[model samples]
Target chain A: MSVSSQDIPTAAISRLVIYLRILEALEAAEISRTSSSDLAERAQVTAFQVRKDLAYFGRFGTRGMGYTVPLLKRELMRVLGLNRTWNVVIMGMGRLGQAVANYPGASDYQFGYVGLFDIDPELVGREIRGLKVQHADELKGFVQTRPVDLGFLAVPPEHAQAAAQTLVSAGIRGILNFAPTMIQPRLIPGSSEVESEWKAVSVENVDFLAGMKRLAFYTLNPHLRPSELKPSELSSTELEA
Target chain B: MSVSSQDIPTAAISRLVIYLRILEALEAAEISRTSSSDLAERAQVTAFQVRKDLAYFGRFGTRGMGYTVPLLKRELMRVLGLNRTWNVVIMGMGRLGQAVANYPGASDYQFGYVGLFDIDPELVGREIRGLKVQHADELKGFVQTRPVDLGFLAVPPEHAQAAAQTLVSAGIRGILNFAPTMIQPRLIPGSSEVESEWKAVSVENVDFLAGMKRLAFYTLNPHLRPSELKPSELSSTELEA
Candidate 1:
């Protein structure tokens, strides 16, 4: 039941979550077991890669029998560290932050929106989706007593770094930054900076830019068919160009 | 300068856009040429990986000279299809949609928010951030004349699928879906269906979930140590678990 650092790849871990989601759907449809190929097809990956990825953790499938839906789901939940609930704090109660707080998916993932924080005095003490908006000054005190392991940064780009610094100083470890700005902060003295990791989950902006690039590429070369473009070739060419 | 479908991995291309943003910041700081090592450091990636990724696009770097600041920036812009403006429409301009509309990063990426749409009569004829909210019935007409390639969906889960179908039917080729729901729609008869092509980019609630998972893993197993967690191992473990 104990997982070491060598246990899994981050990418594979993401896919496992996706696979679990697919399995949940299948289970709801009353399907009992599924082969790697079936899972890969539904999850938009290759069967060989799926098998290889699964093998890295431990064998979860038989040669021909595939995997039991319920057992695999339980195992995935355990491996993903999802068996326990995660306390989440939304650092900004702006429209984006409020949207995130009200996001139904948060409940599905068991991410309890423990508190909401913002600096605007007019907005302070207000309630958003039932979560009271607390002042930013209370972050450290709140973290000391309640102890949040994860924080979401939905503040504007200018405030992102400061917000992250506050969270780090407040003893929060993992941050899902949505500010669409780069945040670089020096680790506090005596803190475990080595183990700390920050993920910049740029939202619709990245996707918008990506979609624009694809459209631009397509528009410029109208004669080229979409089928002619290969993902591998794109990777190689982009690197070599 | 033509890029065929075989030229890049979609994931890598997405990362390239991210790198472009970082490079822009470096350029703004008046940094001239940047070596792969420097770029990697700034982007939180490896030097060799940066070189490898850039090499796939083309030999933009000199053997030891690194990449020229302005020239590389221009090239990245061209590669990411950011050379031209992209008109965007947001459906369901509720809290999430409004957040996206006012997101400063969207404007930086040249995504002009052309309009917002909702079925609610109260919202119709109102303007949020200068983009007038229109009836959902106007979507098809607006798309036909204005010809928007991208659309953002911020509708509730129950309405997501129908909205997506409407957008696809209206000939909007690219979609940025923010609805936290699963959407599976059968291709309309006589409509194009490209297997490798993804016209709709589903931004699931995965980012938050991923951050939570990482935090859980890091916190619950503090003794596991960072060196033990190889990217590949994490991938495999997540898959099998």
Candidate 2:
């Protein structure tokens, strides 16, 4: 069955990501099949919720038998666009940027770090994770020669907007911004217009403080916890985004 | 009116954090009051959503005058348990942990980093951001003398559980786990029992890879973007958690 993207809730996509991770874990454990109930138990959602989430994509399970873990994992990888390699450029090679460049998880999902950019002359010539830190001036030219799908913004708050503008101008398709502040792309030429080339650049924020605040609230109101969190369900907040 | 936390959706609490930030910005600009529509514009949410989320707490807006910025900000801070100081300790002194310790935003919300701990003999005696790194073994004793409300778990995945256990034994009430792997608190003695002392420790996961995966999906399916993201609306994924 054909499915329109709009018909899918963003939460389902987030859940799908979690389900995919569960399937991978199951696969590594030498398990070949999993039932909706098993997936729900592992995901910390109700069985019906798991079925509904998977149903959005199409039927994958047998009525009597559960799903084959490998088959489901592949389907999810394709659905989340993880089956292919995604080239990324990291902006601002500070401590956070350097840490992100070295984060082992990215390469596991095939997110290859193609370029690293910084304004500091001291950092410009440095090689990090085998990629040389290029000056910000080279970003526009670098993208012309190399295909970079996403930019990781880890600069200080004040420079986040300008740095994002640079990434947008460089024709990056998306950004995973770690900067604590918001970056408005309005500074980029034609960003406000529907016909603008840079208008569709999507940004996903990684705010460590937001999680800290939520932990504070949950600590103060444990009884208000949406559920008794299982390890798999502990990251429910991740799905909310 | 008295409100129960169970009635509040975690997504609404996340939004409240963002709204609080917006109110702070408004107060900084010397803007005294804001309409729901205006707050909605800044928050990239519908005006009705702003009203409904705020309604969960109590009526804060006047018919035409809207909400007083400073008053709303204080109310949100109270609702979020951010009005008081929260003593925190960094559990791992790795690169990611150091970056988080130096991050200036935590102090703005009254999250005070009172201690830093690591097992590395090389790092244990070093001082970072004026907080000396102590041996992991010192954690239980440290907390008895100085109260710590939260533990920032930045250890590698393999050691995340053990490090978290150390924090739990030290009586940390919550955890902001930055580890790439999930830490199941089941390892803690009596954690599975309702009457257990360690059963109440809350954990908030900060998975940088999760955000990258969402960005990949959004980049490939821009038409599926939940909404046209303005600067304030850009981090909708943050609220989804």
Off by over 4 Å in 2: A1-7, A25-49, A184-195, A229-241, B1-7, B22-52, B63-65, B186-195, B229-241
Structural RMSD, model 1: 8.2
On a 0 to 1 TM-score scale, where does candidate 1 land against the true structure? 0.79
Q: Could you give candidate 1's per-residue lDDT for residues A102-141 as a string of tens digits?
A: 7656677677889899999977899887878999899999
**lDDT for every model?**
0.64, 0.79
Off by over 4 Å in 1: A28-30, A41-45, A184-241, B37-52, B184-241
Q: Across residues B1-241, which tens digit of lDDT does each residue of candidate 1 receive?
A: 6454464544455457667876776677676667777666555556877776776667787776777778888888876667778787888877777777877677776778887999988888888987789998999999878768577787886788778777766766556667765544322122345321334332222133444555555455554423322222211111000
Judge the docking of candidate 1 as incorrect, acceptable, medium or high. Answer: acceptable
